[model samples]
Target: MTRKTVRIAMNGVTGRMGHHQHLVRSILAIRRQGGLDLGDGTVLWPEPVLVGRRAHALDALARQYDLEHRSTDLDTVLADPAVEIYFDAQVTSAREEALRKAIAAGKHVYTEKPTATGLAGALELARLAQEKGIRHGVVQDKLFLPGLLKLKRLVDGGFFGRILSVRGEFGYWVFEGDWQPAQRPSWNYRAEDGGGIVVDMFPHWEYVLHELIGRVRSVQALATTHVPQRWDERGKPYAVTADDAAYGIFELEGGAIAQINSSWAVRVGRDELVEFQVDGTEGSAVAGLRGCRVQHRSATPKPVWNPDLPATEAFREQWQEVPDNTEFDNGFKAQWELFLRHVYADAPYHWDLLAGARGVQLAELGLRSSAEGRRIDVPEIAL
Candidate 1:
């Protein structure tokens, strides 16, 4: 058995998603587990070089992980012949330029979703990557979630016959920095910094619906800034220029409707922070991040309609909980392993830059639909 080391230049390792998900959970976890076995007697080892602007932060991360490679100079790292892959989790505005440089340097690239802030920019990056013959991918981690996986299994098993609709509720209150510090970054509330709920979330829904149900055909959205002002990280008040909430209705390829509500202003009243309820002719399922509950048509209870009568039946108890029969890894780590295999073992990977461009396209159209107060058709992007 041969052991191979693949050096990955990881940018934006200081950010929350980049540090927590990609660095610690995904790459380091893989290294800790003795790398990924390719099933052909060969194992792929990922050696990550942390790249970020702050040397202090990078050094701290390296010390925390007991890693040796840490670099503040991206150009020097990108030019290194030892670096095989360049992964970006930077801010949306800075992603395109960095990715362009990576592709030009002939490095295989993987990045977080909404690859760019605009559809044209995203498409151009995909085209340029193809022209340079560099393998590229974007994060679509939600598709690998345990709850969604169960939902997918039910769909594959025909448990939900003729899917009717999907309703998704995502989000919880993000505190203003006045009293309790905000959970999310302050940049998320400023539109000037490439921040908005539509751009942040529509890409997720685009792939989720496309994978679990059907491709989205059209969208009607209403975006609003529910919180006009919020305190920044420095405890200074700032006007929230970006939309804090978005209500979207999407038409799927097979005429299935999907309505999702995403908001930073909302409080949690559901079973989880995020949940999707899918109803069909034969069954219904409500899936959260880690749990899924289902109600088959045969097990559905009948109740007499009486507005005056007190509700006695336990509606929630009627549904059956789906068992966790198999162990589930972190979704981000799962996708990272797949990408590594795709790069080294020549495994088939479909979540490419083209797919990423489609996500950006959905976000672009969703914003337009909301601004125009009408349904906007989603056009296919030709790669």
Candidate 2:
């Protein structure tokens, strides 16, 4: 097998998602498996060049992992002729500027979404990347999940004949940082600091909906700061300006109504932290982060609504679990492998910077709808 080395300059690995999912689980995991096979007797070897603002953290990570490269300066890493890719997992507020710099430096770019704070900024990044003629991709990790993949399979196979509606429930209670430490960063609650549930998760739902069911035609949302005050990492209280919860109603292109509720204040009562149920004339399916279950129309149970009587039907047991025909790797890792192949092999990759801009567009529209307190039509976006 031929070994082809590709150097990737990774930024923001000190952060949790950046460190845990992208770096540790994805990139390093590939290296441990003796690199990714690109077929035709070639093995794609990824060399990570860790880059971040925190010098001490970067140094510590490099030393701990025995990584040869670590840099505090983005410009220096960008200048390196050997580095082929620039990967970002930075905060949403800081991503656009860094991406602009990377594109100007002529490196392939891959990043976490929301790619920019606003649709305009995201479009600029996409346009700039296109002008630079460099390969670019944004992480759509959830699309690669086993459950969602199965849901997509059902859709593609026409199991959902004339899809009617989709209901999605996501999120769980995040600690107020008083009684227990908050699972998320303090900045996530500050609107001025690019923190809000609308900006955070709407981007995710956009692509998921478009790929699984249909394109969103319009959006109506209510974004609210359910938790008014919360203690920070320093144990100091601060006003929560951003929304902790959002309820959105989206009209799909094919006339499917989709409603998704995202909340950090709500406690879990479902089997998974996030679940989406899609109903059609032929069948219905419940999809989560990992599991997908389906029930054909013929097998659907019909029960009379009787409030005075106890429900005797076993509704939960009616749906059959979708079998995993093939091994499912970590969603993050799976995407990383495909991206690597995309860059080296120039294979078909659609989730480019433009696709990322679409996510940003939906999020921006959702925010606007919340502010105006009305349903807003989603305009077509172009570079």
User: What overall lDDT, based on C-alpha atoms, would model 1 receive against the true structure?
Assistant: 0.93
Query: Candidate 1 residues 1-383, lDDT tens each?
Result: 78999999999989999999999999999989999999999898899999999999999999998989989999999989999999999888788899999999999999997899899999999999999988889999998889999999899999999999999999999998889999988888898887899989999999999989999999999999998989998999999999989999999998899999999999999989889999999999999998999999999899899989899899999999998889999999999989988988899999999999889999899889989999999988876
Model 2: lDDT of residue 128: 95
Report lDDT (Cα) of residue 65, candidate 1: 87
lDDT of each: 0.93, 0.93
lDDT of 1 at 359: 90
- Against the true structure, candidate 2 reaches a TM-score of 0.98
- Taking all chains together, each candidate's TM-score versus the true structure is 0.98, 0.98
